[model samples]
Target: MDIRRLKEEIITYSQEIGIDKIGFTTADPFITLKGRLLRQRELNYQSGFEEPDIEKRTDPSLLFDEPASIISIALAYPSKMKTHVRGTKTDRRGIFSRSSWGDDYHIVLRNRLEKLEKFIVERYPDARCKSMVDTGELSDRAVAERAGIGWSGKNCSIITPEFGSYVYLGEMITNIPFEPDTPIEDQCGTCNKCLEACPTGALVQGGQINAKICISYLTQTKDFLPETYRSVIGNRLYGCDTCQMVCPYNKGMDFHFHPEFEPDPELAKPRLKPLLSISNKEFKNTFGKTAGAWRGKKPIQRNAILALGHFKDETAVGELEKVLKHDPRPVIRGTAAWALGKIGGKRVKEILSEALADERDPDVLEELEGALEKLNHETKA
Candidate 1:
């Protein structure tokens, strides 16, 4: 079998199946990346979400027997919604980052990879392929960068010249010696836009990110969000895109090649108040198919509560009080108390006082006291 011809045929087939960009690289090992992961772990900058085993994450040898090459694919997602949805002063809406706008990218990319795998197997009869999306041990961005899919922008996303940073990445390990593609040169020289624009200063000077403080990571946590980030998080319900939005390369680069990634305006930017009281079934039906729902509805609802507080939507005062008074989860109840304080009204002090009387959880009690302090300060003024 002619390896070069097979690689060419695979590239042609990838395009036919809607893969926006595809690249190949040797599966030797990501030596440089392993060091970064170790340093990040030492500094405690790593989010607990990362695969615990560093060796499995960087060495492709552990992925399969004699892995000769790795194939990386990128699918462009829409940055803007077809029908814009903005929050009204009375009815606030929470925004989900562009990445989570459509059907779960994992499913979409897996389908593409599976199709490519079948095509290669039919031609070579001995093609051994192992495909993985973001959930896998191998870093999607690292693989995509080395495979020449795009340069690693300071925002830590694969910034393809054609698709910008708004792309979903996935890779497949194969036992084929496909010629490696050239990685893109870094184009963000002297561009401090993303670093300066990061609300939480999550981006380190060069390109490293302290995931602990990243708004995107904080939003996905299934507990009370840190107070320092709550205000900066604003109306973001799922992830933060400020870094990508401010990137020079990402400007005027929105591609809608795959309809699967198209955002549903209502779900992607839903009203903040409705989210607080949404039923489990309703949440699943609307957002389950989207990537943002992977952490379940609690985090989204908690973020929505924070968003309502950020907007200071007095109209939501009643709902905030209700959540504070009755939400079973301490995190939700505590966050609600904070929101009530942010959206103070005539009954705000009374509402918090009542919750405090009934609240037993130490964290919730502290939140109650903090809310009362905010209200007392306002009243004294």
Candidate 2:
């Protein structure tokens, strides 16, 4: 079999099937990535979402027997919403980062990978392939960088010259000895824009992130947000885009190539107040198809309350009051108490005081007391 001819055919077929970019690399173990993951673990900087087993994460051979080469694919997603979804002063909205804009990229990328696998197997019936997206043990970014899909930018994103950083990455390991493509050189020389722009200083340095403080990671947590990060998270309900938005390479880079990735304006940037009271069924019916709903309604609703606090929306005080008094979850109840204080009103002190009497959870009671103190201080001033 002419392996070179097979690689070229795969590339041609990939473009026809809507894969924006395709590249190949030898399935050598990611030696440098192993050290990075170890250091991240030592520093306690990793988000708990990462694959815990470092060896499995860094070595492709462990996943598939005698893996000869790997194929990496990139699919460009839209960075901007086509139609502006407007919100009034009284009805401010929370934003989901561009990643969660449409149908989950996991499903979209997996479908593409399966098609590519079929195409390869038809030509070479003996081809053995294993594919995975972000959730997989293998680092998708590391594989993409090695395969020449794009240079790994300072913001920790694979920045393709044609697609910028707005691309979904996936990889497949195959027992075929395809020649590896040349990796792209780092282009973010002397540009500290992403580090400077990170709201929480999560970008510790170029190509390094402290996921513990990252607003994007924090938004997905199902616990009460640390008090310090609540304001820094601002109006984001799902993930943070400040670093990507500030990258020079990403300038003038918005692609609407894939219909599956197109954002519904209202869903991508929904009204903050309405989200405060959305039932689990309503949340599922509206956002279940999107990636942001993976952590379920609690995290989004908790973030929605925090967004309302960030906006200091007086109109949402009633909703906040209800959540504080009636929500079953202590985290939600506590977050609502905090938001009410941030969005203080004539009745906010009374609302907190009333909730304090019935609040049995120590955390919720503490939040209620703190909010009342803040309000008292403001009143005395």
Candidate 3:
């Protein structure tokens, strides 16, 4: 088979299938990524994937014994229509980053990659292919860069000139020995804006991130958020995008027009009152298909309470008080207490006094005391 002809055909096919960029790379990104992962492990930065089997991540040989090439593709999500900012008065409008404003990217990218694989199989009947999005052990950003699609920026995201960092990545691992593209030079010269813009200081020097301090990880984390990072998390209920938002490359990009990514009208900017009151059943029905729905209602509800706390919305105090005692998740209960404290006047103090009588969790008890202290100071004033 003529490799050049195949490369051109692959790129053409990818564009026809709605993929914005495609490039090929030999199955290795560990030259840069391995050190970063090791540092992250050493710093105790990994949130969900603690004890990440570094051998699996660093060695492409482990992913596929015969791995010869990787086809990296980028699909741009809409950016022009500021759906989050549109038609909403509440801060919850700003909760989710624009990347997550639509359907889950994993599903979108996986489906497209499967179709590409079918096309390749028909042409090369003897060849084998496997596709992975963010799920697998492959270093997608490194693959994309090596494939000449775009360079990785200081925020550690692949930055394409057309799609910016708003593009979702998908990869096709194949045994076919395709010609590899040259890795692009880093384009983030002297710009520390992404590092500066990080609310929780998750971004370190040289594009490394500590997941423990990352709002994206914190929102997705199953355990309680660290105390130091709580105040910095702000109103972001899902992933945080301050780094991308502050990047200059993302400017003037057209909004992604895929209907699959369109924001749900009800969820685009949910009212804080309704969000705080949503039942688990209602939460499932409302956001089951959306990206933020994966973690269920508790984290989002907890985040809503945090947003309310930031806004100091007195109206939320009553609801906050009620949830503080009865919410199944201690994280939710703890955040609710914090919100009540921020909005506290008379009712909040009464509720805290009531909670103190039965609250047993050390963390929740500490939060309760902080709430009471704030109320005591307010009352003395």
Candidate 4:
């Protein structure tokens, strides 16, 4: 088999299958990424969503036997909603980030990789291939960078000249010795925009991020959000886009090349009040197809409550009161309690005063007391 001919065939087939971009690289250990991972661990900066075994993450040989090359693919997602769903002062909405707007990228990218794998196997039956998306041990960004898919940007995203940073990446490790592509040059010169735009200073330097403080990561956590960063998250329901939004490379970059990436305005920016009481079945039916639904409904519901507070929507007081009094989960109840304080009003104070009398959960009770204290201070002032 002429390896060059096979590589060209793969590239041609990739385009036919609607892959926005594809590249190749040798599967040598990612030496530089290994050091960065170690440093992240030392600083406790990791989001805990990463594959914990560092060795398995950086060494392709460990995942696939005698891996010779890695194939990286990117699919551009729409950066802007073609249709807008405007919000009123009484009925504010919460937003899922652009990455979660359309179909769950994991399912979409995995399907494309599986098709590629089948084509390779049909040609070379003995070929070994291992494919993965974001949840995979090997970092998708690292593989994309090494495969020459894009340059690693100051925001730690692979920013392609064609698609900017609004692309979903996946990779397949194979034993085929395809020639590697050249890595792109870093274009973020003397730009501190992403760092300065971070609400909680989560972007520590140009490329490194402290995920613990990041609104994107914090929104996914089931635990109560840390007090310092709750308000900083603003109305983001799942992820933050400040760093990507501020990048010069990503300016005016919007792609509608694929129908699968089109955003449903209502789901992408759903009404906050209705979300507070969304049934599990309703939540799944509305958002299940999107990437933001992976964490289930609680986190999204909690963030919606936080967003109500961020807007100081007095109309949400009724919904917030119901959550504080009736929600089964302590995290939801506690977060609602905090939000009510932030959106203080006579009704909110009365509801908190009533809930505090009967609230039994130690954590919920504490949150009620804190909310009451803040309300009292406001009344005094």
Number of colliding residue pairs in each model: 0, 0, 4, 0
Clash-forming residue pairs, model 3: 78-256, 79-255, 79-256, 80-255
* Candidate of highest lDDT: 2
Off by over 4 Å in 4: none
Query: What shift in Å separates residue 184 of candidate 1 from its native position after superposition?
Result: 1.5
Superior candidate under lDDT, 1 versus 2: 2
Least accurate 10 contiguous residues by lDDT in model 1: 78-87
TM-score per candidate, chains pooled: 0.99, 0.99, 0.93, 0.98
1 or 4, greater by lDDT: 4
* Candidate 1 local lDDT, 1-381, one digit each (tens): 999999999999999999989999999889999999999999899989988999999999997999999999999998888898887999889999998988999999999999999999999998899999999999999999999999998888888999899889999999988999999898888888999999999998667999999999999999888788889899899999999999988889888888899999998899989899888999999899999999999999999999898888889988888888878899999999999889887688889999899999999999999999988988899
| Stretch of 10 with least lDDT, candidate 3 | 85-94
lDDT per residue (tens digit) for residues 1-381 in model 4: 888999999999999998999999999999999999999999999999999999999999989999999999999988899999988998898999999988899999999999999999988888889999999999999999989999998888999999899999999999999999999988888988998988999889988989888889999999898889888888899998888998888889999988877999999999899999999999999999999999999999989988998898999888888899998999999999999999988888899999999989999889999998998998899
- Candidates' C-alpha lDDT: 0.92, 0.94, 0.78, 0.92
What local lDDT score does residue 8 receive in model 2, on the 0 to 100 scale? 97
Model 1 misplaced regions, further than 4 Å:
none
Rate residue 60 of model 4 by lDDT: 96
After TM-score superposition, what is the CA distance of residue 96 in candidate 4 from its true location, in Å? 0.4
